[model samples]
Target: MDMRTPLGRVRGLGSTNDGVKHWWMQRLTGMALIPLTLWFVYSAVQMSEASHAEFTVWVGTQGNPVLLILLIICMFHHGQLGLQVVVEDYIPSESTKMTLLIAIKFAAIVFGTSAVFAVLRLTVGSS
Candidate 1:
């Protein structure tokens, strides 16, 4: 009494409903990283001679804060996805795997959120 469609069963794509979503997220984050990383590197290179005050002022600019936030988010998201794949693949125990995945996700969120908050502080005001 297989519930899967004939083709699904044949292709070994049975009802693991999250497969497509996981794959898509990985690719999407990877794509987002390209431009973000390029911009970051370019900005860093161009700012190589900048003093601390200049950098802080630059961070307070209009779009730089948003770009920094997005960069932090996409970087962490991409890293979390890759680490999840590794844990899923290499970790043997189901309990351990689930624990590691949850920890990875939690850490990513915490770190990413704090980073965005820090950027906001830099961009908004000195206090």
Candidate 2:
């Protein structure tokens, strides 16, 4: 069967939707994290002399909430992306690849949600 037509090899059947938005979002989030991560590291270093109670108080403070939330979101987003890449690279069979992808996504969602809930509980309960 001839795969090419006068239009030249399915050239007219381009993607019905674009994925540039998703690519842009991933890059934007990554860019946002650079400064956020540096701020977090600096904040942590500044708190090195703090006692355990003081450290807890610092984490529960209003100033830290935005950073903490960003950290949580970025950590999970990066994790999910990494796992997906791994699955795509290593898994040979299509069925197994899909199963692993779903599993990874489920685990990421569960872990991220639990972590955020725990942070919220600590911060809110302490206040």
Q: Considering every candidate listed, which one attains the maximal TM-score?
A: 1
lDDT of 2 by residue, 8-91 (tens): 765545331234654565677788789888988999898989997887788887778668877878877777766776777788
Backbone atom clashes (below 3 Å) for every candidate: 0, 0
**Candidate topping lDDT:** 1
User: What clash pairs does model 1 have?
Assistant: none
Off by over 4 Å in 2: 1-21, 46-51, 125-127
Residues 1-127, candidate 1: write the lDDT tens digits. 7787877766744322467787898899899999999999999997899998898887877788888899999999999989988987899897898899899999999999999998888777584
Candidate 2 global CA lDDT score: 0.76
Candidate 2: residue 33 lDDT (0-100): 80
* Clash count, predicted structure 2: 0
**Predicted structure 1, TM vs. truth:** 0.79
